[model samples]
Target: MPLMLPFAVEELEVFGKCTSGMWVYARNSTGSRSGDKIVKRDIDLCDEHGRVCVRLKGLSFREAEADRNPNPGATFPETLESFMLEPVWKPQAVHTEGESLGYARHLVILCGMTGFSSRDTAKRPGGMQFVQLELSQPDIAERFHACADQVFEMIRDLLTEKPQERVLLQVVVPSQGDQQLFAGLTGLLQSAELEHARLIGQTIILDTDIKFEELVAILEENKISREKRIRYQKGQRFGLSWNELDAKEGDVPVPWKDEGVYLISGGTGGLGFIFAHDILRQTKRSTLVLVGRSALSPDKRTRIQELSDAGAKVVYKQVDVAMEDATHALIGEILRDYGKLDGILHSAGVIKDNYLVNKTTEEMQEVLAPKVRGLVNLDEATKELPLDFFILFSSLASTAGSAGQADYAMANAFMDAYATYRNSLIKTLYRHGHTLSIHWPYWKEGGMKVDAETEKMTLQKYGITAMQASTGISALYRGLASGKSEVLVMEGELTRIRQHLLSEAMEQVIPPTAVSEIKESSSTLVETELDTGNLTDKVLIALKLEVSKLLKIQSGAIDVDLEFNQYGFDSIT
Candidate 1:
């Protein structure tokens, strides 16, 4: 006797008219197709242009020995209604607009209960259960907005229809490692404001070593399982152990040769200039390519001349790196002139500080273009080049969220992920290039624009004493020498910043000693009082006490007029 399985379509509705051309439909059967005994049925409606107008997918399972008697009273709709209510399988309808449509190439309609167990529950418990929708062509601004809105409406409907289980919806756009797609997805998510369900916007990088299973795992661990609203890459080791290797200077080896050519994006900026000077000093005979969007001023020209006089060949190109063609042209010109590309210091970025609610799409793109898109352009342009180092300048704001820098934080977070992804590719290809993303805090001098009030608040609330330009440059050089993929440079009492941080990952990375010392120091400051003596005596006593506290020693150990260098005090301090 043969096994008999019954199935039916419960709901049918046409979304919109279909356009002409070839169409592709993909179904992620992680949860739907499983086990041996089963029944499968697929229904697709095609138009005159050979386009898939509508599609319905169904799957079911039954025991071989179960009653095979067909019920005459069972209607198709009634059977489908019961089947849709069953937890075993759910049906989803997808409408493909075909290649000719100016809107989204594919629009997926998710019906049935929202909540379901993840495909890989053993690897990631409580992970997100989702269906991936792929978008091929780029939609116009208005169309993109409409498409995103439509998707959000469907998600809202699912949430309303099934309130018991958590619904996870993901929009997977094929980016091919382009940052523009990521930026577009981010803008859409920000604009849509879908707060009901767990919404994820991801880019699918093709022709890479990233396996499908690994990608799924990354999505689950980083975005779904974690409580954070935004995530770029998953399974990254956040906090590295602060060891003597990080502090010891000469022990860390510089990888670049003196004759190699070095490039710095945003090389006209304050931090960029400092890094340029430092790199010149490190490799005096190296050729330097300083690319920036602004024309070189007379003062900057003199500075470039000074670097030239100091035995470094300096070249400046006023070009926007965000433009892919322009960046590729610049790299081609550099390779033609220098004969080899050695290293890159990507410090190009812009800032548009605003609350998340007030931030506009243009503002976000302005900040992201130079940082995220610029990095992508450089990576794509230099895939075949033998580069020793590709260092990206990120920010501490990426890991520790900032109140008024949502766009900046997201941009830097992309850099963090890009570095990791690029490094993985490099390893797979057996390449000799190193990629590192340095997350830096504010510098006392030559940092971002901050008002006096904001600076004071930063110091008081976050205990982030700004790092000096010299100290920060030294740390950067040390990081490059260490060959670490990611390094975070921050200077301050770790305890104060730790208290302000709400991230569990960050809390785990902080050393216990740093926390205890801050607690002890706070108590000491409370206990110690100003001396009630003459004005001169009070001043002297207060100065001694401050020095003692700064040095982490008792007040009795301080001596006035002593050489500050003996106590590790530099001119900037």
Candidate 2:
């Protein structure tokens, strides 16, 4: 069985005229075939920024599959009056007018009542009781009501149970009732502002004894096409007039196809991959140009191929962005290939963690190599190009100093300062007509995980560790994108470090020891330790006089390598 059919004669003509296949569906929970397999196509006829129309191919009926079709040996006779009272009786009525007029390629007029079986050879009537009617256009509410004035105007057939054989049910005319039921129905429809509705009961009845053909002719005269005019009226047997159908599809505009390119750095890594996935899922498809050093690797190539297979324009190039010449050349090549760059995300980084004492001067230089020098190289190379974003991956240790990580902290500190300086320069250049935006993210996760011992040591000095850094990076990016000058990635650490530096300055203002006490106390302690662990008053006074003479000589000598931890010594001695 087909899912839906073009029942209205006027809509059928439009369906026949359509070179494109159109389909219909019953808007009922029980008859709904949503999520079922259907065919789709690229079309230019649909309204811009709207959902695509679908064409039904087949059916998966619950009733037929469950062996619940009670009418096994029933055959329907083709007549116009047969449809007026019982449309489902003529289940397989193939209307040439419906097909030739372009109502639909194939359709199924869904019914809640049992349908006649055309497969049986005997042509015997099947036993099934039904008082159901699918009203095309009642100009009433969404559903049928029993007490409404419109209810008294419908014609109905009542079925009685008998033990022997089946019989043609007795017809009931609601018009004979004291109050015309159709007037109540018309009132109900008027309140709802509905053009069509449906009604089902124990017997077949006409809520309004209007024929579908007559309604289509009325709709055609009013310039309403057949497809737009046909709607399955709920609970009411009557169909709607042509002027009632809304011909809205033809007046809207069609939208353009999505076409663009997205550029990404570190596109092969975990965070980069996740970002790419989100971009692909949330937005329309676009060409992707990935910049990374590992693009030359076989594993990276394989992964990129997989992404390409999944409908992404995956492209990669091998270049260490830390090198100036290489970065310049690669940027030139990318610009040549892709006419323009949409955006960029820089996630390249390295970590250097060691105690201050253990760090060599050479190691310090090496640690600063990537962020300080590499960033400058990248900035210089891409400055000429019409680039949209320049993101620098930074660290929290830069703002908050770490105890056992002086080198990494100092290096990151340079990055923090450099980013600000570069961004300022870019803005200044923009005032003179160059457009470029710079961003910086500090302490992101996945680059390096700080251990428990390392975190404790770092926190003692910096007051915040790696996790805070990662979160700060994301927030900083968001804030910067929202047009902030420079966002302190971690507000808490920035405040703490500022306070700590200021407190150390206040301690330097006041004196701790007097100049006279330094001269007397130091001489006495030395003399007492040297002179039999005890000193007479005359001996102590003599020691003080000798210390004065030595102090006068102490200012002249420059090279002195005595054990200063033991006691104070004269440079001349």
Candidate 3:
């Protein structure tokens, strides 16, 4: 192990095999300042073509003059005060096992839960089912890795060997703040998908201190389709809930200080920059510190000026947040120059999408560096600061699961856990700091640039629409004001997403998809021929053609209206 410092021994990633004749460039970008305890250096080893083979995160610190003691208070294990803020879920009410939740009658089966898996429950085949697989809290406490293996075996056996059913996996954990462990398990639950069964991932955090009957009561309550996450503390139950913001409402302020200093990782460009724009608009004249791995380009510089034009001071920092010391040095500099730091919006992360069979451990860690380690570095840097908020930009993929995103999904799961961990120490670690992890869906403008066809297919499959930029910003404002540890801001049919995380149940019961129907309708029109099957098909064609001409897009661009509500009407109606 390397000599201990304020920051130490983060992971290193190798992109390609190193070759001979690689030149190394080293430099210090900033002038030395008096009273500075840390120095940063940037070193890059590049090939003859200037391709970077390896880079070093410049972190140099002086020895402490005297013995340093950071925390004088009681340790975490000695008290339960920090764990008081950990998120919990409550039951709607305990109901009969295998009960219906309006969509259809679901076949309910319990597995791995002691004294409950043996129950003879009736099965109902209404195109969907719910299976609750439990992990004992004591088992998790005693042998975690063994329990982890059990978690795999249970889900694997259920999906592969048992009758096809929609899964609502229920995992129970101890009341302690083992956030990393919790989030890691969540990553496992999120990936519990199969070709036959639609799985709605569910987690229950039942305190070890709670009685067994208390656990039984909560399990009965969770059988209803509406019941998902639930937690019990001292025999009292709490439920996991979600919230959305109306775009028209802006009076609920974005959390900001009056001309206060704020930092955003990944803020030099993309969603980070857009977040800066929204933050400044909501809280004018604030000092914005934008940090990213890359330096500002001409376009980014112009955008920074635009932020300045909006009556805000924007400072851009080039730093690898995955590097612990590099991140700490940057945060220390920000606090020293600005006098007081207010908030942080950690939007930094990378995605390495590959099939689990094809992915290497190195690739997994590379993807996790920006999200898991990056957020941890941010927290360590600002743990003692009197900050107001620290917002993490997480993804629905963590909660809902995304194929070929094992590392990405797991990394995001850590973000969810970090939010819980940080909030637990609100009274101890921070003066006024609160943490939030916004489990976000894809945004229309600032999100990944998907083609319209791909975008349309994804939206239709998920029973959701790509959130507009205004809607996403509005959600940020609401998330900060809501005083919740984690929130998923989404627009769409909640139950549809609940049924299959979007058909990962669609395979079993989903009829003709909207995207497919839209394509068929387009081909029929191009051939200038009717489907000749039914009046409904012809009517849809005519409506789409007329709507397409009005919208100035191709007829194929018009999707089938899957969300036809009884209340839907226009002025013509």
What CA RMSD would you report for each candidate?
27.4, 44.9, 20.7
In candidate 3, position 156 carries an lDDT of 53
lDDT of 3: 0.60
Backbone clashes in model 1, listed as residue pairs: none
* lDDT tens digits by residue: candidate 3, 67-163: 2226634211221110001234434434334343322233333333333333322232233343444445452222333344455455555554544
TM-score of each: 0.52, 0.35, 0.55
Better of 1 and 3 by TM-score: 3
lDDT, candidate 1, residue 101? 12
Ranked candidates, highest TM-score first:
3, 1, 2
Error of 3 at 50 (Å): 39
Relative to the true structure, candidate 1 reaches a TM of 0.52
Top-scoring candidate (lDDT): 3
Better of 1 and 2 by TM-score: 1
TM-score top scorer: 3
The regions of model 1 sitting more than 4 angstroms off are: 1-133, 137-226, 229-250, 494-573
Q: lDDT of each model, Cα atoms only? A: 0.55, 0.37, 0.60
Positional deviation of residue 352's Cα in model 3 after best superposition, in angstroms: 0.9
Off by over 4 Å in 2: 1-271, 294-306, 403-407, 430-445, 452-477, 490-573
- Which residue pairs show backbone clashes in model 3? 41-58, 89-231, 89-238, 89-239, 90-238, 90-239, 129-166, 503-506
